[model samples]
Target: MGSLHPAEKPKAIDLSHHLNNLSRSRHPSPLKDILKYMVQPGMISLAGGLPHPSLFPFESLHTRAYAPDSNLAPGETKHGVVDIHIPQTSASTSNIAIALQYGPGTGCSPNLVSFLREFTARVMQPAYADYEILIHSGNTDGWNKIVNLLCEFGDYILVEAHTYPSAQALWAPMGCKGAPIAMDGDGLLVEDLRRVLANWETDHPGVRRPKLLYVVPVGQNPTGSTMTFERKQAVYALCVEYDIIICEDDPYYFLQLPAYAPPASRKQESQQDEQALLASLVPSFLNLDYQGRVIRLETFSKTLGPGNRLGYFVCNPIFAERLLRATEVTTQTPSGWSQAILAELLSAWGQSGYLTWLRNLRDSYAIRRDWMCDLLAERFDLENSPVPTEGVLAFAKGHGSRADRKQLFSFVQPKAGMFLWLKLNLIGNPEYERLRAAAGPNVEAQWNEAFWMQMIEAKVLLTPGSYYTPWEGRDPSPNRRKEEGVTYFRLTFAFESHEEMRLGIDRMARTFELSWNLVA
Candidate 1:
């Protein structure tokens, strides 16, 4: 060795761009906070919003090729690996080990993508399997990447009138604006969106048009309304006209009401009663996209486990490439372990069988929905609340819309997504009805404070309604929306068990009843 040359140590790298303490990912796990305060040993928790682990395919995965060759039989651990056994073929073990390694920027696992592509094609579009796909940490991760790739501060983005809260928050801080498109039973109103965009363009010609449109197509969050095929087409047509991109956020696509009967009846099977078949569905935006403008996000949180935080997005290469670059720069890659585990579960389910499994999940949720609705009926006299329309949400515009907005601060109908989006009466509402119903005008704010305070005093936690609105004016506070007149509160039913769900409803019912007495 000339000059006793040795391997040089790596020089210290300068911390320039990485020095900031900002986070792309959402911290202060909201779900964790709810669980910590609300969970009691014997408390029947309708508060639970996560999937039931009992339903996961742990055994199915272990029995099939999901595992390595080693642990096929009991009490056998090949190579001292705790979980995997290698009796059938050690070569399989090597493949599994490779999956464990850090994958590409998009993802290491293509198995899940392959299955998902096939699934989307057979069910959504026949030609979609040709489109590009990318794995993400979850829907939020995919959303963040898309925002980074396309949006700049004060950029206009179209969202639903009632949409996911986290998405609303993420967009606002980035200096982007969220414009809401009205939604009805069908889904996002294309005609309304067309009018809004046209008006905005005319009013603010100097500003750029909305860069992207965000939506939750299947079992929509907060609203629980799924888009029909015709509506989806109309929306897509509008997007094409406006030349805007579509971000399809569909975490609950597979979590339909458990009442859908397979298409066997189309081939002339025995006629089943309507009561016998109650599965619900409609096509997804990604499935309907012919122009490759849709980036569809799929998540396992609703159907599988939320903690897994595993999801994938499929879009055209133009956006996909940018998104993957963002992923590389941000998260680098989704959890390799989660990708492999899900791939195994998906493989075991097989293609057709997976649909059947999803059907069963629908049934379970349908039962829960029915149970919850019955509870509400018995308690609140929902005739007063908004009627249950779609999947998980119930929207009843009490006294608010017609008269005083404050009077509108009535109870919300049990809607979809394990949440009840409550509409409260605030001073902003010109239609404040609390005055006529009771003493004077001050009753509106008093009632609002009283309701939330009681819920907190009762040890129940819920997300406030204002959290969902985009770029609305607000006062200074830790939760800025509180100071604003966003009188919306979301209560979930997904995580809580049946008994706990009942109890939660009972508690809510009691709270409402007490408030009602005060107003009377």
Candidate 2:
């Protein structure tokens, strides 16, 4: 576990080969380029479609904001108000006049960008010095840009066997195919990645090797798997070897939680400092990206609010310039209102406050994580055990064929993010094969759909794991693919109260019991 502190300046690597024809043909906006002259001393600007702030309908914007440490357990949440009054005239980036006007595609303005760049430098400590940031709508928007930058029609993109479905869906419509790499409880399996990359020509014949890899390294969307530092090192090495650009779509990086233990075995708490907090997190890919191939998609959606629709790319300045060109054409900027509010709010919080806010969020999510797992364990008679992978814990119901067994489900307790990836022993249900054959070619999915509908009938809604499958992954856990007789469902502990969670889990358990005919 080496420190992520910067050891060297980043060296430029030519990744232009990875760019698609469409992106290569793009040029920066001519009008946006002219804004450079608009800032000169007392220049009368008639350059762009500039709306005079005087004609703007609103005089100011105001909202009550949350405190940095809001929502801590056993304490009342504190709040504050951010007021942006559009003064008659002011040149400050944080002023309401500038906030309400046209903004750069880099962000709505330099206000949020400056705050974020400082925060990234201080907290994330990207190992590369030449890295740049470009704000987009969020991870979804950020991902779309990456796909456009690299993936041409019919290009294959590497992805974890299970990934954020939307990321896969974004490129699938472009006629590109998904090259799924195997994964486990610790996220991407390096050997499996190497296996795919090393054997690409043998497998695909004339198809080009995938030039881009999309992964959710923290609290994997469907699987709730977190990558360890060693795992990231290995993955990064493979990307470098294979000459692939890594699109690290890590919205949940700050949601990293401590290992779960049953209440009886749970340890007491200790005071956590900023350094300790940073140390606890698995370093971002940017930390290991000396050659600048990693485009780490950082977002304020999870950290702040999703409605803000703001996120940014941290990568080599070369790739960033191309992405900036793309942005200059499409989503020229995020909502100006969003950037201003966030800029004000974050400035109020400062870097220390931001970390404190993140700490509070991490703790809150961890509590909910505990609540979900604890309820499941209580209802299922689960046996908790340490999995072979680092940062992974699992729960399993009895595997025996005893007639008294009522239901069966297995899951990996999440180490980060909002999901609990669970596998119900649908094979434990008597009609497994009947349902399997009924679905024909799409057996796993249709079979899982039957179970999902059963849960819906029972008034509990959990996402079918099939939705998150990058390809046709038989099992959510790559290590357990050989072990069949199970179907996957993804549940989130991020929303709803403890009582609601319990009620849902109870209903889920009862549904399984009835399906197994263990209930009269």
Candidate 3:
């Protein structure tokens, strides 16, 4: 796919006619509006029940040295170490005085808000003229607020075939239904999306037309499929045509990996080459949004740490204000301490230093990804092997040798993110095929349960694909039936150490060989 040039003009969208009823009803908080002017010079009036900063007892905070480089030698003491310190004073942005005291529900600290604004302008560069940002607890919290603000009960939410489990959990309890769109090696297919929308009324009689699309565009959860710039453009065009609001939940946007190459094919590159690769990532939906239809949910969970519980929403002013009102009633604001600490770090790092940090993170994850993929390849004995037996390849006109047909498993080498989605050869398993025939309507669920148990016994744990699958009642596409009984697993290469990753894969390989009766 070709890259989107910054100078190219994006097609404009009319957002005023696209807002949901709840969004249209929401208005800015009166208290929050007045709090902004309360912080003027030499103005010390008692306002919205804010506590005295002096009563707080915290004197100072200190953290251990942080080294960006992970390749330090065992005895390396003076190579690079920077200790972080925050004093409890009224002057500093990291001061405990403001952190402990009550603050705006929209954002805790002014300095942190300013830093994020600059970061978003430089990185995302949303094309909309009247965009706004609001800090919240995290992506999960942000998603909940979005769902409440945009969707009514029993509304339809369009989602990828396999998506984040937590999103499904949030939608189910609220009486919202998921209409699954088919996906491929490159994430959500634009063709499938068009078909679903075109035949919505016929396929789903009496159901409300879906107005919301929830997608993890970059390094999509579980699937590990990154949508190309062209694919995003096509999907955005559909959204405009259908007047759907896009909730872009992209936590792994910055964790994108470089183009895949065999281990031996990789050669050392210069710093300039590495920098160029980072700058050449696919543009986000927000960048393409000419109208205010896309609400981007960005989190510190993936980049900084989940413990911080901080994230922000970037949307058109209309939706942003409504989301802020929703936030006022729910989480109110993200942790003040987290906001202060992040502001301090970003102020010190600046724009260039922050980009450098992201590059370091990407490189580290890439190392882990390479290690896991290489190990899986060795375990599967896929060295110079043809494509394995699967849906698309099974009935191909020109088939390869019998040896290729004997291969029992395969996976798409993830271009980005921490997951490796392994597609199991359940069709080749005698027990699976036998049970599938006579297990009645609940066959798919039963088979998935049995397969999960076997993997657990083999001492290799993984998230079953069923968790990511959309609800059956809401999915009317014929493609959903074909995937109902399919066996797949999601493995994360983020938390495990190198030794642990290898050992887990080794156990999983043994189980695969025994189950499929494959020769070593």
Task: Report the number of the highest-TM-score candidate.
Answer: 2
lDDT of 1 by residue, 1-520 (tens): 1111113212112212211123333234344445445435666767755455344333222323222222212123433222322122133322344344434566756677888877765555522334567888888887877777667677778888777878878878866766778766546788878877888756556877785888987666675566777888888888877777788887776665533222343232232233232223565675456566677877787766788888887776655655665565567667766776677666655775566555555545655665666665555423343543322332122433333322323333322344445555444433334543566644545555666778777766666554555564342112222333435667665667768877877676556545544233
Ranking by TM-score: 2, 3, 1
Instruction: TM-score winner between 2 and 3, please give it.
Output: 2
Better of 1 and 2 by lDDT: 2
Report every candidate's CA lDDT.
0.58, 0.79, 0.75
Q: Estimate, for each residue in 11-121, the C-alpha lDDT of model 2 and write its tens digit.
A: 557778888899999987898877677878998877778888788777666577777766665234565544444343456646566767776678656767888888778
For all predicted structures, in order, the TM-scores are: 0.69, 0.92, 0.89
Q: Give stretches of model 3 more than 4 Å off.
A: 1-34, 42-44, 64-79, 272-278, 383-405, 472-479
Candidate 2: give the clashing pairs. Answer: none
Error of 3 at 382 (Å): 2.0
User: Which ranges of candidate 2 are over 4 A from the true structure?
Assistant: 1-7, 74-76, 79-89, 385-407, 436-441, 471-484
Report lDDT (Cα) of residue 460, candidate 1. 63
Number of the top lDDT candidate:
2
What lDDT does model 1 reach? 0.58
